[model samples]
Target: MDPKEIIARRVAKELSDGDLVNLGIGLPTLVANFIDPKIDVYLQSENGLIGLGPIPEKGQEDKNLTNAGGQYVTLKQGGMYFDSATSFGIIRGGHVNVTVLGALEVDSEGSLASWIIPKKLVPGMGGAMDLVVGAKKVIVATTHTNKGNPKIKTQCSLPLTAYKEVDLIVTELAVIEVKEDGLHLIERHPDTTIEEIINQTDAPLKYTNVKPMEVKS
Candidate 1:
C-alpha cells in the first residue's frame, strides 16, 4: 500500500464511534475514506462543515462544496453547513471529539510545529491553534521523515502551533503515543523493524508491549 494510505489507514483506527472529528488538510483528509462504514464518525471542517463525506467523484464535484483545504467533497445525508463563526464556536466550545492534523514537525514533548517553514511562502495558520487546544484529543498524521530528515525531534525548531497538545502520532513506520514522560512507541508498521524505526526517528522512544500495526492492503 502507498505510504500515505498506510498512515491514513492506521489513523482511521484511532477513531471511535460517535466521534466529531476535525481532519486537517493533506494526509489527514484521507482518513475519511478509510473510516468504517458501520461507525458514526462525523467529519468536521474548520471552514464550516459537519458530517463531511469522502472526496467527490471526478465528474460529480460541486464547486460550492469544498473542505477547509479547498478540495471538493460530498456531504453526508444529515450534514449541514454553517457560518465560520458557528463553525469556530463548535471547535472553541469543545464540541469536537478528535482532531487529526498533519505536521511539519512534532517533538517528544508533544508540541506541534506545522504552520510555517520560516522563509517559504505558505498559507497562514488556519484553525489549528484553536482545534488543538479545544479538541478532546489531538492526533498528528504525518510521515516519520521529510526527505530523509526525521520529523520527530527532541524539540521543534519551528514556531509551534500548540504546546504539549498532541496525544498521538501516526506515521507510515509506527504508531507513537505522547505521554507526560515523552514519546512512546506502541506499534510498528508490519513491514518495519524496531531498529529501523529507531534509526529513522530522531527523538528517543520508549516501548511497552510494542506490536505490529494492523494495516489493511
Candidate 2:
C-alpha cells in the first residue's frame, strides 16, 4: 500500500462526529478519501466555504467551486459561501476541531516548515499558519524523510508555520506526538525499528509508553 494511504487511514481514525476540518493542499488532501462514510466530518475551505464533500467525477467537475488545491469537490446540504478573507475568522476563532496538514519539515517543538525553502523556489504559505494556530488539534502527515534525510528534526531550519502548534505526526514508519520538549514516539510500523527511526531523523526523540501501531486488514 502507498505510505500516504496509511497516513490517511490513520488520520481518519482520529476524527469524531461533527468536526470542521481543513485539509492542506497536497498529501493531506487524501484524508477525504479515507474518512469513514458513517462519520460526518464537516470539511471547510479557506476560500470562503464549509461543508465540503469529496471530489466529483470528471464530467461533474464545476469550475466555480474547488478546494485550495484546485480539485473540484462537492458540498454538503447546508454549506454556505462567503468572502475568503472572512474565512480566516473561522480559522483563527477556533471553530475547527482538527486539521490534517502536509509539512516539509516539523521540528521537535512542533514548528512547521511548509511555506518556503529559501534557496529553492516555493509557493505561497497558504492557510497553514492560521490552521496550525487556530485548530484545536493539528495532525501532520508526511514522509519520515526527504531524500533519505529525516523531515522530523530537532529544530526546524526551513521556516515556521506556527510554533509548538502541532499535536501529532504520522510518518511511514512512526507515529509521534509533538510535545513541548520534543517528539514522543507513540508507535512504529511492523517492519520498523527504533534504531532505524533514530538513524534517519535529524533530531533526538523520546519514547512515550510506545507500542507497535497495528492495522486491521
Candidate 3:
C-alpha cells in the first residue's frame, strides 16, 4: 500500500463508533476512505456537511456536493447541510468528537503549525484554529518528513495554529502520542526501525508500550 494509505488506514483505527469527526483538507481528508463500514462515524466538513461519505465514483460526483477542500464527495443517508455560520457553530460549540488535520510542523510540546507559511501566497487559515480548540481530540496526520527534511521539529519556526493542542501524531513511520512530558512513540510501522524513525524526526521522543502498527490490506 502507499505510505499515505498506510497512515490513513492506521488513523481510521483511532475512531470510535459514534465519533463526529472533522477531517481537514489534504491528507487528512483521506481518512474517510478507510473508516470501517460497520461503524457509525459521522464525517463533518467545516464548509457545511454533517454526514460525509467517501469520494464519489469517477462519473458519479454531484457538482453541488463538495467538502471544505472543494473536493467532490458523496453524502451518507441522513446527511444534512447548513450555512457557514451553523457549520462553524458546530465546530465552535464543541460538538465535534475528533479532528484529523495535516501539519506543516509539530513540536515536542504538541504544538501545531499548519495554517500559513512565512511569505508565501496562501489562502486564509480556514477553521483550524477553532477546530483545534473545540474538538475533544486532535490528531495530526502527516508524513514524518517533507522532501527529506524532518517536519517534527524541536520547535516550530512557523506560526502555530494551536499551542499544545495536538493529542496524537500519525505518520507513515510511527504513531506518536503527545503527552505532558513530550511526544511518545507508541507504535512503529512494521517496515521501519526505531532508529530510522528517531533519525527522521527532529523533535525528542519518549517511548511507551511501543508496538508494530497494524496496516490493513
Candidate 4:
C-alpha cells in the first residue's frame, strides 16, 4: 500500500468502540475511510459535524454536508449538526476521546508545529490548538520525513501548536509514543529497517519493547 494509506490504516487501530474522535485536515482525514464498520466511533468535524462516515460515491455526493477540510462525506446514523460555536464547545469541553492530526514538525518533547511554515504562506491556526489541548489524547499522523528533512526533531524549529501535548505519533515507517521519559518507538513498519528509521529521525529514540507493526492490509 502507499505510505499515506499505510499511515491511515495504522492509526485506525487506535480508535475504540463508541469513542468520539476529531479528525483534523490533510492526512488525518484519511482515518475516516479506514474505521471498521462494527467499531462505532463518532468521527467529528470542526465544522459542526459528528458521526461522519466514509466518502460517498461520485453520484451520491451531498453538497450540503462536508468535513472541516471541505470534502463531501456521508453521515452515520444519529449524526448531528450544529453551528461552529457548538463544535468548538465540544472540543474545548474535553468530550473528545481522541484526535488524529497531521503535523509539519514534531519534537521529541511532543511539541507540534503544523499551522504554518513561515517561509510559505498558509492559513492561520483554525481549531488545531483547541483540539490538541482539549482532547483526551492527541495522535499525530504524518510522514517520517519531508523533502528529505527529518520531521521528528530534537526540537521544533517552527512555531509550536502545543508543547508536550502529543500522546502518540503514527508515521509511514513507525509508531512512536510520547512519554515523560522521551519518544518511545512502539512499532516499526514491516518493510522499513530499524537503521532507516534511526537515520531519518533527528531525535534520540527509545526502542524498548519495540515490535514490528501489524498491518493486515
Q: Candidate 3's C-alpha lDDT? A: 0.91
Best by lDDT: 1
By TM-score, the better pick of 2 and 3 is 3
Q: Name model 3 segments beyond 4 Å from true.
A: 58-60
Query: Between prediction 1 and prediction 4, which has the larger lDDT?
Result: 1
Model 2, 164: alpha-carbon shift in Å? 1.6
The candidate with the higher TM-score, 1 or 3, is 1
Candidate 2: residue 55 Cα off by (Å): 1.4
| Residue pairs of candidate 4 with colliding backbone atoms | none
Model 2: lDDT of residue 117: 83
lDDT by residue for model 4 (52-95), tens: 87789999999999988888998888998999899989998999
lDDT of 2 at 119: 73
The C-alpha lDDT values of all candidates are: 0.92, 0.85, 0.91, 0.91
- Worst 10-residue lDDT window for candidate 1 reads 117-126
Candidate 1 ranges with C-alpha deviation above 4 Å = none
Query: Tens digit of lDDT per residue, candidate 1, span 167-188?
Result: 9999999999999999999999
Q: Candidate 3, residues 1-217: lDDT per residue as tens digits?
A: 7889998999999999999999999888888888988889999998899999878889998889999889898888999999999988999898999999999999989899998886894666889999998899999999989989999988898999999989999999999999998989999999999999999999888885789999883
